[model samples]
Target: SQKIEQNSEALNIQEGKTATLTCNYTNYSPAYLQWYRQDPGRGPVFLLLIRENEKEKRKERLKVTFDTTLKQSLFHITASQPADSATYLCALVSGLYGGATNKLIFGTGTLLAVQP
Candidate 1:
């Protein structure tokens, strides 16, 4: 089994501020890391993906960075709002070089609460 660590407590942020979350894994190496947003009672929605070879990737209002050396990934959301309040998860495919045979493992997830 794969285990990744995220913030055990919910992160509270003010509206229009930038919220950053961290994911760290101690066991396995991943070819890529992905970020997702999940609302209560809803499936996770894909947000970003950063490969091991890539340093960073960004989407509107969101940015993700992957650091293979540190076995960590950081997710950032700028100008965050109440709508951005949700559980953010980090995931990766467990295999050498992320082949199709690899299974995806998701981190425990960190909840972000944006206050307006």
Candidate 2:
């Protein structure tokens, strides 16, 4: 069995600053990790995905790092603005329960609030 967890609390930061969120996992070795952003009443939008062998991945102002050795992943947003305020989630394919379907299991998610 594998479990995923993200910061349960909301993060407050000033606009134009950087926001960093963490994702931790236990009891499984996933082939990759993914990050997504979700607004209230909306489904999560895919942000980035990093393979276990990849150290880092970047897209626009977003960067994601996956460290299999530590069973953790980090998601970063640079030059963040108030529009960036939303809930961020980390998801991974469950190796134990996901046999051939490769089901995705998501973390609790972390709320980010960028204040101007």
Candidate 3:
């Protein structure tokens, strides 16, 4: 069985510091890993995607590292701020598209609270 878990508690940090979050999983052979950001009731917005063969990926102030050996992923937000406060989700891309779109399985999420 495949399972994913993210820190459910809110992470409080200073505006200029880095915010790090963890994602753990068990029993899943996922094709690719993805990260998304969700604000309140809004749907998740894609952040970064890293294939199984890739060790790390980054965009702007965000960085993600995937360790298949550990079955875990880490997300980092540099220069955090109140505007960066939101819930971050880690997902596993599962199933073949059969030439169509792939399906993604998302974890609960970790709420980050960045202080100004």
Off by over 4 Å in 3: 97-101
Lowest summed lDDT across 10 adjacent residues in model 3 is found at: 93-102
The global C-alpha lDDT for each of the candidates, from Candidate 1 onward, is 0.91, 0.94, 0.91
Task: Report residue 30 deviation for candidate 1 (angstroms).
Answer: 0.7
Q: Which candidate number has the best TM-score?
A: 2
- Per-residue lDDT of candidate 3, residues 1-116 (tens digit): 67899988889999999999999999987767999999998999999998889998889999999999999999999988899999999999777646476778899999999988
Q: Which of 1 and 2 is ahead in lDDT? A: 2
RMSD (Cα, Å) of model 2: 1.8
lDDT of 1 by residue, 14-34 (tens): 999999999998887788889
lDDT of 2: 0.94
lDDT of 2 by residue, 27-88 (tens): 97889999999999999999899998999999999999999989999999999999999999
Q: How many clashing residue pairs, candidate 1?
A: 0
Q: Between candidates 2 and 3, which one is better according to lDDT?
A: 2
Q: Model 3's lDDT to the true fold?
A: 0.91
For model 2, give the 10-residue run with minimal summed lDDT.
94-103
User: Candidates 1 and 2: which is better by TM-score?
Assistant: 2
> What TM-score against the true fold does each predicted structure earn?
0.93, 0.94, 0.93
